[model samples]
Target: MTIRVVLTDDQPLVRAALQMVITDTADIEVVGEAEDGAEAVRLTAELAPDVVVMDLRMPGMDGIEATGLITAGTGATRVVVLTTFDDDDYVYGALHAGASGFLVKDMALDDILAAIRIVAAGDALIAPAVTRRLIKEFTRPVVSPPRWSELDGITAREREVLTLVGRGLSNTEIAGELSISIATAKTYLTRLLAKLNARDRVQLVILAYEAGLVATSQ
Candidate 1:
C-alpha cells in the first residue's frame, strides 16, 4: 500500500529537500505540500494523507496548533513533527498536541524515513529519553485528571497495554511480556488507540502520561 504524505514547512527549499528524500521510497508518496500551518490543515483535509511531516515554526498556525486540529478533526491522518529544535519545550508541546512521531531536523534522511514508516505502519514513537525530556519540560505539576468512566470500558489488559505503550515498549516487547503473539498485542493496541481518541501509540503514550496512567515510565 502506498503511504500518502504531506510536507508542511515555511521554507520552499526545505520542503523540496524533504520531498526528494520521501519520494525516493517506493512505498511512500508525497500527496500534497503546504507552505504554512493553515495550508497544512487545508491540504490535509483535501488529500487525507496517511502521514504529515510538519514543521513547528511555520507562520499563521504553527505545528503544535496544527497537530491538535489535525488529530482532533481527522484521526485517520498521522502527524510527524519535524523541526530544527529538539528543544524540550517544542518537542513536548508537539507530542502533547497529538503528533504521532517527533524527529529533529538534524537527523539523517534514513532516520526520518524510518520514523515515517514506523508511524505509517500503525503506531510507533521516538526513544524514551526523547519523550521524557519533553515531558519534564512541558508537563505541569498540576494534579492528574481522573480517568473518565469512558476509559473504564477498556479492559484491564488493555490498560496494561497502554502502560507498556506509554513506557515506550514496542508491540513485540508487549507480546513477549504478556506471553502473547505480536498480532494479538497489536490488535489490543489498535483497539485501545481507537477507544482513547488517540491517533497512534505515540499519542496514547502522551495521554497515558498526562492522565497518570503510567508514571516514572516515560
Candidate 2:
C-alpha cells in the first residue's frame, strides 16, 4: 500500500527537498504540503494522509499543537515530527502531543524516509542519539507529577515490553531479549497501548519512563 504523506515545514527548501526524495520512492507519496501548523492540520483533515512530517517552529499553531489536534481529531492519520532542534522540551512536547516518530533534520534523507515508512507501518521510531538523550532526560525532575498510575492495568509481561520500548528496543530486539516470538512481543506492545491508553509506541515509552520502569543509568 502506498504511504500517503503531508509535509509541514516553514521552509520551502526543506519541504522541496523531502518532496524530491519522496517522489523517487515507489511506496511513499507526498500528498500535500503545508507552510505552517494550521495548514498542516487542515491538509491532514482533508487528505487523511498516513503520516505528516511536521516542523516544530511555525508562524501559527506550531507543530506540537498541530500534532495533538491531528491525533485527537483523526484515527487514521499519524504525525512524525521532523525538525532542526533536538531539544529535550521539543522531544517531550512532541511525544506528549501524539507524534509517532521524532527525527532531527540533520539525519540523512534516507533515514528520514525510512522513519516515515516505519510510522506509516503502525510502529514508532526516534533517532538513536535522540533516544539516548530522551532516556537520560527522563531521569530529571519534572514540574508535573509522573503518571505512574497509568501502568496499573498492564500485566508484568506488558510492563517488560514497555520497559524495553522505553529503552528504544524494536519488537525484534524485545523478542530476542525475552526469548519470545516477535509476534508475541508485538501483542504485548499492542496490549500496552490499549491498557495504558497510549497513542503509539512513543507514548508507551513515555509511560515507561513515568512509571519508573526504565533504568535511567542504563
- Top candidate, metric TM-score: 2
Which lDDT value does model 1 have at 189? 83
TM-score per prediction, in order, is 0.79, 0.88
Residues 1-218, candidate 1, lDDT per residue (tens digit)?
A: 98999999898998898889877789889999998889999988998999999999877888998888898883589898886643556667787788877777888888888888888887665566655555555554426564656477799999888878767677788899999999999899889977887656677777677667776433
Q: In terms of TM-score, how similar is model 2 to the real structure? A: 0.88
Positional deviation of 59 in candidate 1, in angstroms?
Answer: 2.6
Error of 1 at 3 (Å): 3.0
Question: Which segments of candidate 2 are over 4 A away from where they belong?
Answer: 127-130, 137-140, 179-181, 215-218
lDDT of 2 by residue, 63-116 (tens): 999999999993689899976554666667888888887767888989998899
lDDT of 1: 0.79
Q: Which 10-residue window of candidate 1 scores lowest in summed lDDT?
A: 133-142
lDDT over C-alpha atoms for residue 180 of model 1: 92
